[model samples]
Target: MSSGIALARLMFVVLGLVFIATASLRARPQSDVLIMRNGDRLTCEIKRLERGVLYASFDYVDGTVSINWAKVARVESRQLFIVQAEDGSVYEGALRTEEAPGKAPVRIEVLHPAQPARVFEQGRVVELHQTAESFWKRVSGNFDSGLIYTKGNDTTQYNLGVGLRLRRERWNGEVGFNSTLSKTAGVSASTRNESWVQAERLVGRKRWFYAGAARFLESAQQGINLQTTLGGGAGRYVKDSNSARFSVLAGLAYQKTQYEPASGSQNPPNAMAGLFAGNLQLFRFKKTALELSASALPVLTEAGRVRTYVNSSYSIQIVANLWFKISFYGNWDNRPPATFSGSDYGTSSNVSWTFH
Candidate 1:
């Protein structure tokens, strides 16, 4: 046999093996529920192949669907689950554990396969999350938004603010800033301004969540008031929904209000201790969310008396990475300006940009 002919045969053999390898990695048809490496399961209507990833519409508790996608993790039979190995081999069975479960090796049971059962070597199987995390952050910023509203007196002011956030875990602490401004004209004079630095940490693994924060506010003529608050609550996933977080929280907040009159007069310090309760939610369509809360001020001061307030907001996603947050807020007190009531509402839309 000629040397050139032998080389050509070898090349054909190599090409055949490559074809088999590529065909083996093809994605299977869609399924009802997809369980991720992070132990989160999503129930969605698997749409169609857009680019290369599987697009899905997640079912929400409130009869809505939000678009999402499956990470590039290995998937298996409709009845059984399997994860693929870097060496072109598959570990079949229920996904025993995440790719890297801290100190233990991930295990899988074939049950009916040729090998019957196998425990995956952490070194051989690539952790799907490691790559998915980085890839998602690159593209996730394309969508985000919310709505807020506030009201005081017969004259109500409306303000709106919206922004995007980067979330790590399925639930974790996120930092984002938003500002809203609005004015109301009525029998009584009114102006509203609200902005805050939002930070929240997920403390519970299961739905019993805990979070705390310090909010700094500079409202219309209200000067600067800082409030320190801590709270905890529980939530549940209704059936296979992805957008509703039904929760209730009760917490203590201490607020200090300072004001300097435009007439060059200094007002005495005003401090108030109060309790707040409300429901937190992520609404349907992945565009709207709401929180309805009330605060009670029982203690009285010389410069201030007992008062009660209600704060509620609705956030709407207008476009990719931008949203309009509107708040309906109100305040009522016994102090006589004789029938002192105020209501304020406003909307703000924020858009985000990323620089590589």
Candidate 2:
């Protein structure tokens, strides 16, 4: 009977310890705080800031909420984050807003435990990414697919695109694949495929970067079996902001082309070219986004020969990470093998999904 009483007392002690531990965890403060221009305040966990939107999670809320960056008045967070500015400067640290009088421009302070603190204008900050323990959490990508059918000609067409990006403190990498196939009654099928890999490294505390890329293409319409290009160059951002970004690059490239037998070029020639390219991106909060890219390759080995490429896309968010996209692509070569077409252009509408 005495041993039973001792066991009961021990059990009571264990229960008390568990209760104290649980209560301590529940009382811990939230990780971040946000203030709105309308005088509202929120205590929540900030996920990231991208494309003029700040994503956050609240304990009382059901899911992640997106707030417009322009509407934010202040923010404070102790969690480490990767912040990027319009001038191509990047910082990693905790974030806080400076106290300012009415009508004054907002400023953000980045405080690092081991490094000196830095300050930047709030409007000049373009992106923020939370530093996660898992590497996969730092990756983001999108996949899009489209289909078209016509009963009159018994024609069908399908297109698919996939892209993946990995961003780090000073560099980023991207991979992309796109394909289109079409079939029609009493007509031969046609196909086009393109794949590319690109990498960029930040140069300094300004809007400068170095980029390298490799691309492969196959097009039945252009009578090309395969075309491969390798290039590297330096680029600068002309404009970088929440609503728009524009950049240009100039480089040198080498291209090797293999023509189909019917094109009558048994021995295909390789050429070295000068590359000029530009990219533009525009965003409208959560509503819409547009991207445009163009490149020109002037063959140095063969004078007067040129190749050009153009790609443009407009996307409207339907809900959350799902979007409706309309895209156009064009490829042109001023000179081609005998009997081969010199251009291929097409348009597609697709449904796309994005994830981070």
Candidate 3:
């Protein structure tokens, strides 16, 4: 089974390469150019500039490469782009770069005719996206997993995770899933499963209508076999800069739970709860990404309990689009169901091939 799963992951990589090739072949032409430090001049379509890297697709090359912006001596493009800076300012226009001697940061020149030329250091440029993006261009995400086996105890473990997102001018949608399982000879097996779907619609520059539903099933922790949450509310983007974003959200949440040992288990609460959530996302774009997030739900009924989730992750690129990821997860219950603990936490590392 492990071998089969590994093979499947390999197939995914192969298919991802094929898709990139096809897309590059079909990409619309643009007046974009990138000059590398090695004196290589590439005539390509600059799909986006994010974090500290530039994503470019070449008509001649079969696959796209993420170029470290620092390694790029200059870029000339006439294609319209939505550029965002670390200061939360945004512009729509082409980009020009003035090379600096040695490793000094290149001066980025934003050519906005209506507005004067805005100059910034390379690091201050948070994100750039082609304004001509299509419906498909707004889609991106990734999935990955890792497996382990122990011969001494005849034990095996595996963790899997996946995420997908679609973004447009007015709204965005995201879906995610994660699961972990372990088994040992003569020992009861344990498993955890989680999934969520979320959507947000822009109401202003930094405010949005937000909603999501999530479900979790865990047999080893809290003796919980299942828990589901559904809610909706508003979100405020505290920081909407190019390099990072921070958001806070609040509203109402409804929760239902089913504990393990179903026959005689303590029935968990089904209550209307006040929910609060926040998240911080940072993209180095060069090769690293970081995310920190949490959710809290306080029950108002006799339950007198609070449920919370905290998650953190860091990822670094290992190859073209394959990234090595380390993630930490925490589940907490101020008042747990009978036979359950108050909290559970763990970490996992895996490799994933991400796509956009």
C-alpha local distance difference test of each model: 0.38, 0.84, 0.73
Best prediction by TM-score: 2
Provide TM-scores for the models.
Answer: 0.44, 0.88, 0.76
Candidate 1 TM-score to native: 0.44
Off by over 4 Å in 3: 1-26, 35-41, 59-62, 70-125, 130-134, 207-220, 240-243, 261-268, 283-287
Q: How big is the positional error of residue 73 in model 3, measured in Å on the Cα after superposition?
A: 7.3
Q: Over the stretch 241-314, how does candidate 2's per-residue lDDT look in tens digits?
A: 89999999999999998777677874346889999999999999889999999999999988898999999999
Candidate order by decreasing lDDT: 2, 3, 1
lDDT of 1 by residue, 229-316 (tens): 2323333322112333334444545555433234232332454444444554545443566656565554334345554556666666
Pairs that collide in candidate 3 are: none
- The better candidate by TM-score, 1 or 2, is 2
Cα RMSD for candidates in order: 19.2, 14.5, 6.1
Give lDDT: candidate 2, residue 277: 99
Clashing residue pairs in candidate 2 (N, C-alpha, C atoms within 3 angstroms): none
Where does the lowest 10-residue lDDT sum fall in candidate 3?
A: 1-10
